[model samples]
Target: MIMRPPGKSARALLAATLLAPALATAQDAQGQNVTLELNAVEQVDEACRISFLIQNGHDTDIAQAVYEAVLFDTEGRVDRMTLFDFGALPAARPRVRQFVVPGMACTALGRLLINGADTCTGDGVAPDACVRDLTLRSRAEGVEVMG
Candidate 1:
């Protein structure tokens, strides 16, 4: 049998094929898929205001989503923790929520950790549960998504 090394095109194709599933997972993790984006964290006078966007990817409407976020300092130590309680984040619509933390600033943050959804009840009468089966696309750049 004759053997030959893969060329550039072949290597590219092989790499793409191998990374397809990982790329899709990066875009949207398994289980209940949703996208959470950090909008801005700014220091307003004496308080810090953190804003983020949450987009629902399910067919059912999300009535409320409560999460606890932990902020780490530059020394990789726990700095502070806050709760983000959002209401009525409907399907296919992105909802923005802002929370203010006193005596805190964005500069003091080294990493953010989402500690999972405490409450993820769907909208309408007798809504479905959406918290038990949720996956997170944790980039780990500065935030770790634990869902």
Candidate 2:
């Protein structure tokens, strides 16, 4: 917790208060803009791994990212898949997050989440039929704290 000097809070609050007009101005950019769209599965492997993609929505300059997940049925199974959330930290190298599916190592989904640097979800796919959601996480800037 940050401790403030006595009476300093009042002065800070008075000086930093935002006006109604200012709030409206800051929120003026709100809109239902399409940031990205999921593409089809490019390939799958013997390990049941899956690969998928998403296309950046209509603008090359907008470097957004995609987030995705997968589901299975009665006969379906997965072991683990590593995802690279490229959109999480634009300048950072790709991440490889491994999730152990509800199955054996012999049949893990060969496909995993591939975060895009906007518009480039990579030319990849899985080799089998599985329910995987290709979702996107958008941002105007890389505003994340470093560990």
- On TM-score, the leading prediction is 1
Judge candidate 1 at residue 107 and give its lDDT. 74
Residue 136 deviation, candidate 2, in Å? 11
lDDT per residue (tens digit) for residues 1-147 in model 1: 988999999999999999999987764553345677766777898887777777776767887777777878767899877777877778757777788888876677667777766677864513334444443443324544444
lDDT of 1 at 134: 41
Candidate 2 lDDT, 28-112, residue by residue in tens: 4322122222222212332222222323222122243333333322244432333334343122123332323333332322322
lDDT (CA) per prediction: 0.69, 0.30
RMSD of each: 8.7, 15.9
Q: Estimate each model's TM-score.
A: 0.64, 0.24
Which residue pairs in candidate 1 collide? none
The lDDT of model 1 is 0.69
RMSD over all Cα atoms, model 2: 15.9
* Model 2, TM vs. native: 0.24
Best candidate (score: lDDT): 1
